[model samples]
Target: MKSAPRSAVLHRMVMPGHTCPYGLKARHLLRSRGYEVEDHHLATREETDRFKAEHGVATTPQTFIDGVRIGGYDDLRRFFGLRVADPSATTYRPVIALFAMTALMAMAAGYAADGTVLSIRAGEWFVAFSMCALALLKLQNVEKFATMFLNYDLLAARWVPYARIYPFAEGLAGVLMVAGALHWVSVPVALFIGTIGAASVFKAVYLDRRELKCACVGGDSNVPLGFVSLTENLMMIAMAIWMLLAYGM
Candidate 1:
């Protein structure tokens, strides 16, 4: 003897201009869980509103199992023992991903140029690539980045325009470093910004004991302003010194 398959009823939005994503997800979930779904599409705004008002629910994609309401998509997920995301949780995933990607790029570049993945040049490339990537993120919205940067950067606080200019300087230095050219220009640029950045991060995070978001990844980023930020600046400073010693006469 075998038990019959579970059955579910789903009411979801399917408007002309906008189909509800949660509704689609709910339908998919029901099918995947071996439920025979009787899906009802509220195809118009009026119909959707009527459905909501009648059901006394504020949101759509409502589900029913065994003649009992199972609520919306999130509710359905909970019923299935799925993990729901916490919107306010802090994470270091962005910086971790950035560093990982840059390391891989550095290794690839090393292999392409010198026929080996591990070398002094690979280390240099890693720093240079990271600088370029960070600069790109900041450059996406310079004004936003400048606002966030002014919070901790001593130089930016004193000279407001430096906040805007910082990304370009970092990017130019990085490009030059990667090319192994124009050491005269790149070395000074990297040293100046890196020194100021390290000092600012140390003062804000260590000395002043303030917890804040990092502008290193960009203004909107949730990445914490602390060790990772300091490391970025230190790497830049070290790279500048290394390039100067290796190329400067």
Candidate 2:
């Protein structure tokens, strides 16, 4: 039997600025292959650039299987083909997007009044602020969001990362929403916001058996199987089905 080749991943671990999105996803992809992975986060732009120049890595998380560069996360995904997208293995980008969108939008609307799109409240700000967070999660792992309450977390503790970062970002969006910063057509804005969140949640869960994890209260979420959580995601799923049906129609 031919032995499996050893592999490693190197990611520049920095917060609030770096493109760790694709990098982390790549690492997760490699992890699924049972390879020896090593991640190195570039702390400074100079370091990252130097590493990039040194290794000819235009981006990260760059993959090295026995000292060979294989590009970033999407490349690795293609390398692993559809296998890494499986929850039973590694990589869950779709699921995370779905739940994250719904949760962030709901929290954003929480600080607004009926018919008043923008107000001097926290909820409004959170609505806008969630965009960046949403982008990051999708950039990392959408599959996890799709199958949060499934077999993936059974072997990993990051079913919920310790980073209570989402809640804080939501707070920022809520502040903006309430401050009436986004008062330019709030209803449609809210709906649009909700739609993105819904789509993210729907995609994530659908790819992972329609099972879901309740993304409430940020990282410390513990609201039980409440009606809102169930409906928010289900509505997203329904919307997705509608889109699919419309397209197929």
- Steric clashes per prediction: 0, 44
Name the candidate that leads on TM-score.
Answer: 1
Instruction: Compose the digit string of candidate 2's lDDT tens values, residues 1-249.
Output: 988767675665565565576766667667778776787777787877888899876765677666766676766777766534333432234345645664555555653344443443333233344443443443354444334433222212343441233333333433444454443333333344345444444455555454444553222223332343435434433433433354352
Q: Which stretches of candidate 2 lie above 4 Å from their native place?
A: 1-5, 15-19, 83-249
- TM-scores vs. true structure, each candidate: 0.88, 0.32
Question: Compared with the true structure, what per-residue lDDT tens digits does model 1 show for residues 51-159?
Answer: 9999999999999999999999999999999988765665689899999999999999999998999999999999999999999999999999999999999999999
Find the candidate with the highest lDDT and give its number. 1
Alpha-carbon local distance difference test for all models: 0.94, 0.48
Kindly provide the TM-score of model 1 when superposed on the true structure, using C-alpha atoms: 0.88
